[model samples]
Target: MSDDCIFCKIIAGQIPAKIEYQDDDILVFHDITPQAPLHLLIIPKKHITNLNEIRTENADIISKIFTQIPKLAFQFEISEKGYRVVNNCGKDGGQTVFHLHFHMLGGRHLEWPPG
Candidate 1:
């Protein structure tokens, strides 16, 4: 884990978060600054700089994260209405944190051309 990464800190128990789920490889939690009524952040326990850094060895963990998404949406009751899963790649993608993570948003109608 990256010493300075906020998500890593949270995973390490150094920081507190409204964690929704956790396992040996993944961590799921509510977003501090939510864009929708239901906004959750899903991340890997392993420190990955960004999507561009995903390697063949990371496939299993990545698959687990994606498989857990729908369950999370259903658990939060956002599945029927639909949801959005987002990954910001770099600074230009509006990613403030470098650790790889996905934003799950729902509970409202999402418009096209997200900024």
Candidate 2:
């Protein structure tokens, strides 16, 4: 893990977060700054930077994150209506944090063409 990465700290238990789920590979937590009623971040335990850095070999790991998304949304009672899964790839993509994370947003109407 990167020594200065915030999400790394959270995963290592060096920092505190409202964690919702965790396993050998990923950690799920409520976003400190929630955009939707059920806004959460599903991050990898290893520091991956962003989607642009993902390698083909990481397909299974990426699938694990996607598979867990609905399970997590179901726990929050937002799975039936639908939810949005977002992964910002770079600075221009609105990625504030360098860590690779999937934003799970739901529990209300989400606007199309997110700004």
Q: By lDDT, who's the top model here?
A: 1
After superposition, candidate 2 runs with Cα above 4 Å error = none
lDDT of each: 0.94, 0.91
- Summarize candidate 1's per-residue lDDT along 1-115 as a digit string, tens digits: 8999999999999999999999999999999999999999999999999999888988788899999999998898988989999999999999999999999999999999997
Give the Cα error of residue 12 in candidate 2, in Å.
Answer: 0.8
- Of the candidates shown, which would achieve the greatest TM-score relative to the real structure? 1
What does the lDDT read for residue 72 in candidate 2? 87
lDDT of 1 at 39: 92
lDDT of 2 by residue, 1-115 (tens): 9999999999999999999999999999999999999889999898999987789877567989988987887888887899999988888999999999999999899999899
lDDT of 1 at 96: 96
